[model samples]
Structures are given as structure tokens and as C-alpha cells.
Target: MNNIKSVFSINDLENLSGIKAHTIRMWEKRYTIFSPNRNTNNVRFYTTNDLKKILTIAFLNNFGYKISKIAKLSETEIISLAQKIYSDKTDSNFAISKFKLSMFNFDAKLFHETYDKLLETKDFEIIFYEVFIPLLDEIGFLWQTETLTPIHEHFISSLIRQKLFAEIEQAQKNANFSSNEVYVLFLPMGEIHEIGIILVNYLLLKKNKQVVYLGENVPMENLTTVVHHFNKVNFVSYFTVQPEEENLNTYLDTFHQNILVNSPHKLLVLGKQVHNFTSFIPSIQCFTSIKQMLNTI
Candidate 1:
């Protein structure tokens, strides 16, 4: 079956195109840029074709094209202009914009093509840091602001995760180090976000360290067992949404009493929830960002 998106709401367009829903309504009302189908309840719905057209319109508008002029352009003309913008190799922002289009269309081909083209001039790390990271930040903002849906976020995140895992597997195969420290990565219970931890795992492998990746939603009770098994263990975790502000200290205290008190190990944490604590458990280190964590690792 084709993965083409056949139905969309105004919010979907707003999320995918970075155009406000109010502005989209204005374009539809004033310039007839979109001819949406309304349901019995009078809710607006759009087809995949509308999605494509709006993506082009948004891209052109970003380039200073007037809405009045854009509304008059033929479909072929708009598509040609979009293709030109997509092919502009000098604009890094265009790369991100194209990826947003791909996410909206569920077009994996577009994502792969854009990434491969970028790899011609830069390595994966550079593309990730410069393009993908900023793209992710935008996606997060869109999700938070209710402009993007979970489906849209998941589509892009899953593709980027595949690349991260591929790199990690390759690194693991070639990794050889004499360091006795074994890094164990996991997400706390109730916390399902693992991309940050996965990236950290990749970084650890790249630095020639051994990583025992337990993955997401690991039980806190298991940490003691893991530490007991390894001679020199370094527990690494990402707290994206787990361990609520009130529970953060309690969780750390649990780890302090159960794992660190009896073992000779260190805890390194990275996430948005790390700063809510007034104090950290002994032997625990909190990082504000990926770069800070990478520097210490």
C-alpha cells in the first residue's frame, strides 16, 4: 500500500508547513489558495494534493513570494518552484524544510534522498548536529504548541533513530578499548523517551567504551543487579519525561541508597528534568545538554 497521506486537518497543515492555521484560513478566504472539503459538521478536511500545494506555498512564501501571486500560479508552476527550492544545495534551512515536507507526506524516499545528498559534503555527525538536531527542536516545539501531531513527530523520529542505531551498530563492531569502565544505559520507569540515551550510547561506542544498552523504561530495582555484575560500572540515563519534578529527588535518593551506597560506581544523567534538583546524590553528575555529556564522556 502507498504511504501517501490522504486526509489532513487544518492543524496538520499548520504543523507540516510552519504556517499558522489562522494565516492558512486567511489565504483560503482571501486568495482561494485552498479549496478544502467540509464535513457534515462543517469541519475542514484536505487531500494529499492540498498538502503538497500548501508545502510549496509555504516554501515560496518564506522566499518572499506574495500570497496573491502564489494563488494565481498553476499547480505545475508551483511544483517546479518547489523543486527548485528543494534542489538549492547552499541553503541548510531548505534541507530542514524539505524534511518537514517529507514528514507530512510520509515520504521516506524524500528523507533518504535529502540525507544522502547532505552526506556528500558532510559527515553524519555534522548533519545530525546542524540539521537533524535543529529539526528535532522544531518538531518538539510544534508538538508542544499543538501544531504537530504525535504521528508526525513519530514518523521523523523513527527515521532519524534508524540512522543512529545503524551508526551505533557499526561503532560497536569496530570498538576496542582497554578501559575497565562499563557504561550501562537505560531510561527510568515511566520514561519512554530513548533517543537521547541512544545517542549517548552511540557516543560511548564511538569513544571506544563498552556499552550495555538496556534500552527504555528500565526498572530502578535492576540497577543494583547491573552494578553488581560489572566491576566498574557507570550508569547513564536520559530523563526526558520520567521522574516528575517531585519524584526526581526521590528517584535519585533511591539510586543513592540502593545502588551507589553499596557499589563503587558513578551516575551520569542528561535531560530536561535534571535541573529541578537542589542537590544530587553523591557520585551523581547531571548534564544540561548533549555537548556537556559528550565532553565528560
Candidate 2:
């Protein structure tokens, strides 16, 4: 709790707030929204307070609140209005800001609070797609830009995983796997992203389909033993940065021959790598999104 970053650069602000650095500078010049503390070298940087205020403003701005009017309000008024907007739950931007702050500060309680607040007006699936997906997408770019450390990613990811587990557990209490085809969820070898797969698992369970979650970085050879357990099954996988573009088709061919040949089983593919898929096999299916896959299956 005490070890989170105390300072951020303009680029960091741009990335986190979704406001360009020039706009931030213009806001400062025109409205004097928040003062940035300059370092010894006279470079512009922002304190954690500046970040919180920007997120608050951005939350409202995205929801139709004007910056000109926002600049006219007192800090207390701004916070109070934000709270009212939250209570109304008309937009996910407020929740997204809270989630981002939780990730940056490594605050589990804040994450849970935000999730609970969203749950009051939204179902788990709505919250996942609306708030969580955008937050996760931003964090991915933030990590790639070196604006956030892996530790930051892991901390927030663990909190989200906890919620997913809780949701999945609650759904499982009334387990009904009456579907004819069993679903096996996994990620390809060398792929470590598990959040998408877990979300899919939750949805599949919601559909009353039996699911065998093999998890991330699963090798092709290791799946034979599991597939033999079900008479007819669908292998669901998310391909996020595991099989390189050049090797993706080869990987698919290997899976088709090794696992799906002359069998009633099929493979369902999801994730970013599916965009490169030019041709299709009879048994292998690629979906553009989780919702599409859910609807199709």
C-alpha cells in the first residue's frame, strides 16, 4: 500500500488519462485545473494527487460533463458530483477510473469496492465486458510502454482473478453440464494470458456446459490424456502472443493432425492471433470475440 509510485511523467498522464499531453498543457494554461510540480531540471511531472484529479475529471468528461464547467467547481464539489455519478451508474468510465487507481496503487480493497459498486447495477458479464475489458486493454498498453511494471500488472491481475474465481464458484454451486459436448479451455504453449480463458470458462459454465480448464502454457502433447476422457469435446483456446505469426498455421496443422483427426472432437480458437487466419479447416473454428464464441457455442 505504501510502496506505490508518488510521481508520474506527462506521457504517463497521457496514457492513464487518455488525454494527450498537449491537451493537459492547454488545460493547465486555460483552466489551471491542477498544478504540476517541476523537478530540479524544470521538467513537468505530476504528483499522485494530480493523477486522481485527472481521472475524476476524465471520468466525468467521458460521460458528457464539460471541462469548462468542471474547472469552475471546487475540489469538494467535483468529488461529490463524481460520487453522485457513481451512484447513478449510467456509465462505466467512473468504474474504469477506480479500477485504474486500484491497479496503480495496488489496493485490493478499492478494487473489490469498485467491483461491488458495479455489481449493484450490472451483472458479472456486463462488468467484465464494459469495465474490466477496457481496463485490461489499457494495462496491456501501459505495460508495453514501460509506464507500468510487471508487478503492477500482477497485483491487479490477481485481484481480478479472485473475482473471476468467486463468480465461477458461485455459478458452479448449481452446476448443470447437460450439454452433449464437453469444453476444454486452455492457452497455447508459451502463452501466459489466462484472464480471457477464465472469463470464457465462467460463461461456458453459465451455459451449463461441462468445462475442463487446462489453463495457460499447455503443450499440445499434454492434452491427449485429457481429450480421451470425453467422447465428444470442444477445445477452446486463446492465442495471445504464443504462436508467432509465422508458426501459427504450423501449430494449427499440428493440432489438427495430432488431436482432431478422424474424431468427433473440434477446436475453437480465440484471441489476437485469429486475425491472421486466412483459411479454415473443417474441424477447427476461429471466433472474432468471446461473446461471438459464446453465442455460437
Best by lDDT: 2
**lDDT by residue for model 1 (1-297), tens:** 334456788987887777999999999999888899999999999987787788778878888888898888899998787668656644566678778878877889999998888887788888888898889888888778665578887889999999999999899889997598899998998888777888888888888989999998788887778876789899999988888987888888888888887667988888989855545466898888878877876
Clashing pairs in 1: none
Error of 1 at 246 (Å): 1.9
Error of 1 at 69 (Å): 4.4
For every model shown, the clashing-pair count is 0, 0
Q: Estimate each model's TM-score.
A: 0.84, 0.94
Candidate 1 wrongly placed segments (more than 4 Å): 1-6, 41-43, 90-92, 141-152
User: Residue 246: error of model 2 in Å?
Assistant: 1.1
Clash pairs for candidate 2: none
